[model samples]
Target chain A: MKKYTNTGSKDTRSGFGAGMTELGQKNENVVALCADLIGSLKFDEFKKNHPERFFQVGIAEANMIGIAAGLTIGGKIPFTGTFANFSTGRVYDQIRQSVAYSDKNVKICASHAGLTLGEDGATHQILEDIGLMKMLPGMTVINTCDYNQTKAATLALADHHGPAYLRFGRPVVPNFTPADEPFVIGKAIMLNEGTDVTIIATGHLVWEALLAAEALEAKGISAEVINIHTIKPLDDTAILKSVAKTGCVVTAEEHNFLGGLGESVARVLALNNPKPQEFVAVNDSFGESGTPEQLMEKYKLNNQAIVEAVERVIKRK
Target chain B: MSNTQQLQDFSTQVRRDILRMVHAVNSGHPGGSLGCTEFFTALYQQLLERKPGFNMDGIGEDLFFLSNGHISPVFYSVLARSGYFPVAELATFRKLNSRLQGHPTTHDGLPGVRMASGSLGQGMSVAIGAAQAKKLNGDKHLIYSLHGDGELQEGQNWEAIMYASAKKIDNLIATIDLNGQQIDGSTDDVLNLGNLKTKFEAFDWDVLEIKEGNNIDAIIKGMTEAKSRTGKGKPVCVLLHTVMGNGVDFMMHTHAWHGKAPNNEQLAVGLAQNAETLGDY
Candidate 1:
């Protein structure tokens, strides 16, 4: 539907690992805890360079979350890394009490998020993570689009003093954003200006939103694409302004539509500016073992679906 | 480090604080707190080399985590007497919007509490985590954890025990207050912990037994032995045998006072047994 330049791709997890290494060297108080996914989480650098700051907590996500909370009490900023599923679902209570409700400054670094975890199947691919995290009070939820943005977001959460869930994914995605873009938390990045409809996307869907915008541009429809990396603090002004001018909306994410970015955006728009919105996300269903492309096609989480959602919303408007 | 007399006096003072704090609110777990007073006092006064002012990170100081958070009275008493907070704050315990709640939580920004541990069976995991943090920070300071025998029913403690042994978390030396009484009744009646030493050994932990846990001198010796056994690749799990309601004649030997506060009449009787060495909060 859209023609875009191909860029070199990199796994977002590497962004986390590289960012953590840089942050560890810069701040002595920055500590890391990993629950048996050292290689997967790319925590090898932090562990090697700052051995004292890296905790290889073997298969203890619950304990790791708790210990991370404890480290925060001592004025230490702790980053906990694990798969998205175990990080959120496995230790929800621990995060809810020790981190979120208690308001500890811990970075819940989650890798292998969404269906892109690929072949690890339904169990490892956690689509409900954003929903679970967003429900908790005082929790700042972030879903970075690509490698560069995820890397920047990881470093940014360390400076912010509160409980934060930094969600990233496995598959190597397009590394199009500037290598050193400043990641402003809770602020949406406007990729393109348009007047017909607003395409609000997050995480892997940011690239899709860009693709849909190019297709819509060719079809005489000006689609505004917004990258909503930070889902919790929804950047009300930017979102409302874009929605007010566009008069319709379409949300895209690699997660379930129930409590993911779509619902968050809908809530913000409902309060500020009521507009017709269509969600382009995994329809209330769990993921299965498949290739990233297969999973995307099966879940209807591709650029074509996003463009269609935008067209439907535009027609309704 | 405190000598024998200092340990005794600190133990008495902690017991006094526990009684008064619980009596003030007419709500708290006094039985186990009373039972573990000497053990906790001995550990704080003689065992731990702490800084004068309390810091949350405890970078240089040894860390202690209470898994059984219901026994907040004993923990609050020891913390206050040990100069973790102003002794006067003991009266504010469980009061309206006080740092000292019914459970140990960092929510109030309390200096000593590192995590919220009202949910049982999570403290050991948290302790092991803190111990792991110490290792990660290259800080060789030891960590201490106390748990009630009956509270072991929460399977997470055993999971942590298994993990510590497997990971060789040798820097952590934990003590289990084997008072053998829960709110329901004896540990045997509630859920048989089924041979704790055997369990710890099976879990590959360096296990030790303290027959006279409530005795301050014995507590000092046992903890010394526990500390000596560390630095190897196995985490130390010391089984401390203590009475449910120790120190006070009437409260001892039963689970009735496990969570019940001492009424005014019983409060006087309990206070008579423990003199306020550092003055009442």
Candidate 2:
């Protein structure tokens, strides 16, 4: 097994801010719009650097979405920033009619995703965003795991045409991915290779999967860990190849199991390779106010949960 | 022929196209289409300074967006007649594999359509955004959009309405088709949009009214004045008060033909009412 080190701990939202700051200098056509959450979304540096390019849309997300779609008409790549809930559910029809259906180049950057959003409670934390975005035709859905990856994905989306949804969290996590690595929209990263079980994870759950692999290695069991950053146009080849070697799979994500990364992986497995699978995700329910650690522990989304799921799936295989 | 007479002839021909397109499909909104024929005709034929061909990135030229896209018959007619596409293609309106979908969309690579609208209250924001883009590009061309008065009930319209004035998007001229009727009933019965001039003025927009909305001459005069109001630190709004159906006497003064296609007898009546001066497609 290969070892990876955490360079440091940083919140993914700040990484988005970092990426926007770089893009402000690099691409003149890259414009940013925020709905009165400039500080929460960490868009201060980008706003300060490119005061002309940054648009403060004041609390109107629907209008923000419409304006972003229109901005694409005159060769401007508009990046809209808001919470995950406001980004997806609040303005779905606007996205459907303007951006996706019209096939405009707009990047919808969402922060404070999933249960890791912590004390803001169920209203702010959105878990169904991936599903809503993926269902739209011609929409690229990317959920970055760490700070470095989030920054890379933000830069990558500028070159990508059409509509996309880039999801990240508010909680700070280990920045494991390399800073200079080029971000691919649909490619999956192989974190660790093993034979006993395959553990596929996305978003914040990716680091947890790595920790679970280390724990399983200590117990004389080999576990393969794959990081699926892009949920839609999923890295199906990587998933199928790893599951072929392990014969059993465990899918993890910080989302509802009903319509999330786990279900997407399960569909792939069910279609081609029939294998025993376990899901490490939020069952059909809403999240409440709690610390990020407490929510992960209570919702069974940590490394311990993956370790137990691996043990159960291995036995079934 | 003089310019006003030619535009009136053009509008009469366009009114014929609206009736024929809807009558052929047996589905579509013809009331607003007939109602807005003069406005569309005057904008495309006289008011707008447009390029010869259509492109998505309409730089260095004026751009127009149809917010209440249910009136696509009139929009398609004006776009085709103005040489964006072949006027014969208007026969394929709402048919399968047709570039002309029920709602205007750029998805089919249709020229002259920058945004998909049938879902109301979205085009104003799109127009404002395009206007801002023009400002960013140093392109002084204007962005024009038309919406239904009933579409004002949507919350998103209010948001965009508030935003345009606040941002000082002076390069946009948004016109509201005050036909005073919607699908369910009259605008007054469904929802009273009280005092539109005051509402827009309070929102800090430059407001004007074309009382003779169905008249080609009045529409030209009003829109030309609306153009002069640009670059003055406020977005302009034109409240165009028109009848639901203008030329066809049977269809006028009511919301009956809002989305309903006319029968053969009524189609004959409508066609006879607006004598085709420019020939039918």
Candidate 3:
């Protein structure tokens, strides 16, 4: 079994802020727009450094999206920052018409996604953003797990041509991935090698999946852990190869069971290889106000949930 | 021929094309298209400082965006006649695999289209952004956009309007096609956009009005003056007062023809009213 260590705890939004600050220095064409969430989105440094390149759109998500799309006409790569709910659901039509349908090069960087948004509840925590963004043609969807990965993904998305959605969270989590790791779009990173069962995880759930594998190893069951950062253009080959080695799979994510990473993985499995699969996701219900730890524990999105899912799926296999 | 006569001939031909193109598919918005024919023809022919060819990044040339894209007939005609595409391709309007979509979109690699706009209240922000981009790039070119009067009912327009003035984006000129009609009924009956001149002025924008938007001479004069107002630390808004359906008598002054296509008999009548100055595509 391979062991992973947490370097320190840092919020993923900080990684985004760090990445954006670097982009401002490196790329002159990189412009940033925020809909009155500069402090929440952690864009203080970038805005301070690149005042000319930054636009503070006041509480207008739709207008912000439209402006980002238009900036592309004159060869400007725009990154729009906001909460996931306002970033996806609130301005879906604007994104669809101007950015996705027109194929504008805009990076929709969303923070505070899923139940982990904490205390803000269902209205602010958006679990269906991945599904909404992935459904748009030519849209690349990436949900990075930790601080290092989120920062790398932000820098990587600046080079991508079409519209992209980069999702992160508000809570501080384990900074596990390498600080200088090259983030690859649509490519899965293998965390551990095992044959007993495969645990595929994304976003904040990825760190939990690693811990779950260690627990499963203690129980004399070898669990393979794979971190899927990019939800759209899903690495089917990696998923299939892992599933082929281990007949059953446990898919985990901090999102709704209906339209998140689990369903995407299920579609791939059902199309290619029909196998025993168990989903560790929020079962089609809205979230309530609570701390990040309480919500993750209550929603069964912790390492224990993955362990139970692995046990149940192993029996089915 | 004189510039005004040449532009008038082009406007007549564009009106002819708008009527025929919408009639061919038995679907499209011809009322506003007809209403804005003169504005489109005049802008493309005499108003803009445009390059010869089309490119996605219009860095050095004046850019035009159609915010009220349902009236794509006039826009498509003017773009084709201005050498953006083949005039013969006007037959493909609203057809599958055609670059000329029902509403203008850049999805099909349409040359003149920079962004897709069918849903209302989005074009203003895009134009403002492009104008800002021009400033950022040190490219001294203006951005122009057209919108329907009723589209102002959408709240997003006000947001963009407020942002434009606060940011002091002086390189954009957004025109409103004040035809006084929407899909359902008159703008007064539908939403009542109370005193657009006052509203724009209150928003700290430089406001101008053209009482005769259907007249090519009036549009030319209004747009030329609007052009002079640019680079003066305020975004300009031109409120163009036009009849709903300008040239075609039966369709004029009514919202009934907003999105409905003219029948075979109505098409002939409409075409007869617009003289074939440069010949139809």
Candidate 4:
């Protein structure tokens, strides 16, 4: 079995902030807009360094999205920052009409996603943003796993010419990925290779998948772990090759079971390999106010849950 | 021909195109299109500082966005007649695989459209963003947008309105087609947008009223004055009071033709009222 180590603990939002600060200095055409959450989105350095490039849109999410779309007209790359819930749900029509349908070069960077948003509860934590964003035609949906991956993804999307949604979380987690690893859109990263079962994880659950691989290896069960950051253009080649070798798969995400990574993987398998698959995702339910650790444990979104799902899927295979 | 006569002739041809295109399809909004025919003609013909050919960036030239996009017939006609696309392509309006979408959209790579704006109350924000980009680039050009009076009911407009004034986006001229009618009924009966001029003034905007919006000379004068008000401290708003379905005696003065197409006989009546001067597509 292969082993992984956490370099440190860091929040993905800070990675975004670091990336934005770098972009402010590097790309003259890059601009940022915040809908009354500049501090929460960690945009202090960018705002201070490039005041002319920042727009404070004051609590209006719809206007922010529209303004971002419009800024793309004269060759300016606009990045909009807000909570995940407000970014996807509140201004869906604005995104649909002005950004997605029009094919504008706007990057919608959403933070505080899923139950890991902690005590702010379901109203603030958004679990359906991935599905909502991926449904738009030509939209690139990316959910990074750690601080290093998030920063790399932010820097990479500046050169990508199209509407994209980059989803991240608020809570700090294990910073395992390498600092200089170049983030590639729509490419899955293979963490460990084994022959028993394939564990495809994304977002916060990626760290848990690594832990599950170690635990499964202790029980004399070999596991293959893969991190799928981009959900829209799913890396079907990697998933099919892993599932073809393992004969079964377990998909994990910090989202609902329906219309998420699980469903996407299920479709790919059902269409190609037809392997036995299990889902480690939230059922049809909303999250409540709880600490980040409490919510992860209560929702069965930990390493133990992934191990159990892998075992169940291996049995089916 | 004089400048006003030339524009009036072009506007008459635009009205003919609107009536014929809607009548051919048997579905479209001709009421607001006819009402704003003169405004469209003047803006595209004489007002806008346009480049020779179509370009999407529009950095050095003026840009216009149609917020109330149901009135696409007039917009499409003027865009085609002004050489954005082939005038003969007006026959493909609302057809499958046509760049002329039911509303103005950039999805099909339409030459003139910058954003999709069938959904109301979004154009002002987009225009402001473009205006801000012009400011950032020191382009010294202006951004223009048109909306319906009824579109102000959407809350997003207020957000954009407040942002434009607060940001001092003076290089934008947002016009409202105050035709006093929507798909439902009169604006007064449905939801009265009380005292729009005063409302705009309270929001710290430079507001002007074009009482004879359907008149070619009046629109030209009003739009010229609106352009003069730019580059100061606030955005400019031109409240154009036009009769719904203007230029056609039968369709005028009512909301009945708001979204309804003209029948064959009705099309003949409308075409008779506005004789073609620049020829039809």
TM, every model = 0.90, 0.99, 0.99, 0.99
User: Candidate 2 on A189-275: residue-level lDDT in tens?
Assistant: 998989999999999999999999999999999999999999988999999999988999999999988889988999999999989
B1-281 per-residue lDDT for model 2 (tens digits) = 23988988988999899999998999999999989999999999888889889878999899999999999999999999999999999999999999999989998988899999999899998998999999999999999999999999999999999999999999999999999999998999999999999999999999999999998889988999999999999999999999988899999989999999999999999999889898899
Tell me how each candidate scores on DockQ against the true complex.
0.39, 0.88, 0.85, 0.85
User: lDDT by residue for model 1 over B1-281, one digit each (tens)?
Assistant: 66788788888888888888888898998899988989888877788877777667788878888878898988888887777888888889999999999998887788777667777777787777678767767788899988888878876676678778887889888789898888888888988889999989999999999999888888888899999999989999999999888888998989999989888998898888887776777
Candidate 3 has a DockQ of: 0.85
Give the fraction of native contacts in model 1.
0.36
Chain A TM-score of candidate 1 vs. true chain A: 0.97
- Give candidate 1 misplaced runs (Cα > 4 Å): A1-5, A21-31, A44-54, A70-77, A101-104, B1-10, B23-26, B135-140, B262-278
C-alpha lDDT values of all predictions? 0.86, 0.94, 0.93, 0.93
Stretches of candidate 2 above 4 Å error? none
Question: lDDT of model 3 at residue A300?
Answer: 96
Off by over 4 Å in 4: none
TM-score of 3: 0.99
lDDT (10s digit) by residue, model 4, range A1-317: 77777899999999999999999999999999999999889999999999999999999999999988889989999999999999999999999999999899999999999999999899997888888998999999999999999999999999999999999989999999999999999999999999999999999999999999999999999999999999979999999999999999999999988878999999999999999998898887899999999998898889999999998998998
Instruction: State iRMS for model 1.
Output: 2.5
lDDT of 3 by residue, B1-281 (tens): 23888888888899899899999999999999989988988888888889999999998999999999999999999999999999999999999889999999998887899988889989998898899899999999999999999999988899999999999999999999999999999999998999999999999999999999988898888999999999999999999999988889999999999999989999999889888999889
Name every residue pair that clashes in candidate 3: none
Models sorted by lDDT, best on top: 2, 3, 4, 1
Compute the interface RMSD for each candidate structure: 2.5, 0.5, 0.7, 0.6
